[model samples]
Target: MTAPTLFSPLKFGAFELPHRVVMAPMTRSRTAQPGNVPTALMANYYAQRASAGLIISEATQISPQGQGYSFTPGIHSAEQVAGWQGVTRAVHAAGGRIVLQLWHVGRMSHPVFQQGHAPVAPSAIAPNAKVWIVGEDGLGGMVECPVPRALTLPEIQAIVDDYRRAAERAAAAGFDGVEIHAANGYLIDSFLRSGSNRRTDIYGGSIEKRLRFFYEVVDAVIGVVGPDRVGVRVSPHITQRGMDCPDMVATTLLAARRLSEKGVAYLHFAEADWEDAPLVPEAFRRDVRHAFGGAIGVAGGYTLDRAQAVIQGGWADWVAFGRPFIANPDLPERLRQQVPLATPDTSTLFGGDARGYTDYPRTA
Candidate 1:
């Protein structure tokens, strides 16, 4: 039995993976209502796709203050922790490892989600992006983001404490590890890119200062679960939601090195997934590989051949599949057997029932 194309084994920290396929973090907005919590439906959803080497759960808000979207799960409350316990057990029962992606949307949030206060961030800049929120009509609508109030030093300490607490909750919920969601113009990503962060305090103005929030967050999380069980996801080339900046690549690479020094288990790069998205330059990947001596995971519109080329040549240790995994529960097996992938139902992608969430059929 020769090794399968992209089905090679990989060592992601303490765990040994049977294959190098990852289920990238994606927000499906199917969590239970009233208080954002995971459900049995989510447990079934993740268990069906347990073939992946690792499963990074949807972006989960750390605290009430971290929330920015409707129907997204949180890890702060007791109910939320109990809710995720089911999901983690289901994945583990199916013989898979899973991680929760901790998220805190900064300026991307509307005042509605921020409890009538301006969303907080490293600086008082507007993202000029919109976020999904349920309005007076009881329907989800995109609302313009408000200019976030800059976080004071004490507030910054509080947010870091929130991340640490969230990590503790994830461990209590039985997660294999935790991934910091610092990409796609969220709080950490905003602090890293100069376009979004315009502060003159110790938290901004220079590359090192701009990265202070992220470093502190990572340090806090590491204090909770150790560095080997933590991963950081970053988006260097994404042009989405006013996050693109001239200094994006340089800052991301520098942040990657700092994460490596923190002894992070892996660096997950969220490559551009849109049509006509900018390609991740070879030079950037080469630099990242040399600078970060840990596992590298890449995701964004990748096919089997592209994944094979990267992993086979040592450019990345694994490849994460996002949308494809939504419709194909047995994605890794299908890819290993060269089966055609099922098309995703984008209509039911968010804020829906199990129709497009857990109703996908398992392949033979």
Candidate 2:
């Protein structure tokens, strides 16, 4: 039997991908201001990288209350939906498949983004994290997250409805699918972890309860987009932003099994990519594989060799490249041809214009 390489074709849900190189969602913070809507430049940026098997868009807030960072796009408003239509049209024109990543930051948000109201979470705990906010001078910097107020029971139900509406808007915006952003210590991630979710209600306590909010949101999204057009991203080993959950791996596995039962299109693991971050254990990967019969994708600091190895090992069906995709728009081709990858400018990463976002020279 031959080993599957990174260049292997993959049939992920309704999309027949030409290769296994997926473009991970990255927040460039270059959206059109005032409404935080997707721009034509953003559409160009995505079209430039259209060769990837799949492109999971940057985390787009589901509502005004879901926003945590400055200039990040949203999916709630009619104008926002129309803006994203241009983006989708551009990507489709370039022969690419793209999905919008639905997001809610939960307690990882600052009051500025919340219109002076405290951010909402499963519990009233601060994430001890910082969100990037651009100051009046247009200089973006990290600001500490304050202790948030807990969401009321009614509010929790409302949030579930928010997920459903967001999925509907995503479909209207012409997205091929929607990837629920339940990772990176965001809203859904907070509820899925025991350490963060101290709620004693049906939404917290035991592992099953801790997974309630996540399941509700996922179910709501699936109801709108159907299971085949839904994908979920989870991070079991990431302990940053006060997400130091002891049972995260177990919780993630449980979620995977249920999502598999729901027949989701795929499960994407957003592995911690820091130099000192804990490695996602192969044992856990095996557990997820056993639990999830659908396509599996992983994103971290994966190079071509590592991606090939993981795919060949049967732990993952595809690989998502983040930072590498920023600098090399034709990253899949570069990896295929074994060319050197370009480095992205860190200074221009967050709130910049085209210099770092779309001006990267392609060597094809």
lDDT of 1 at 18: 93
- Model 2, 1-364: lDDT tens digits are 8887899888967778999999999999998889998999999999999999999999999999999999999999998999999999999999999999999999989889988999999999998789999999999899999999999999999999999999999999999999999999999999988888999999989999989989899899999989999999988888888999888888888889999999999999999887887877889889999999899999999988899899999999999999999999999999999999999999899887898889999995
What local lDDT does model 1 show for residue 146?
86
Clashes of 2: 0
Q: How well does candidate 2 score on lDDT at residue 120?
A: 96
Which segments of candidate 1 are over 4 A away from where they belong?
Answer: 1-5
Instruction: Give the top-scoring candidate (lDDT).
Output: 2
State, as a TM-score between 0 and 1, how close model 2 is to the true structure.
0.99
Per-model TM against the reference = 0.96, 0.99
Number of clashing pairs per prediction, in order: 0, 0
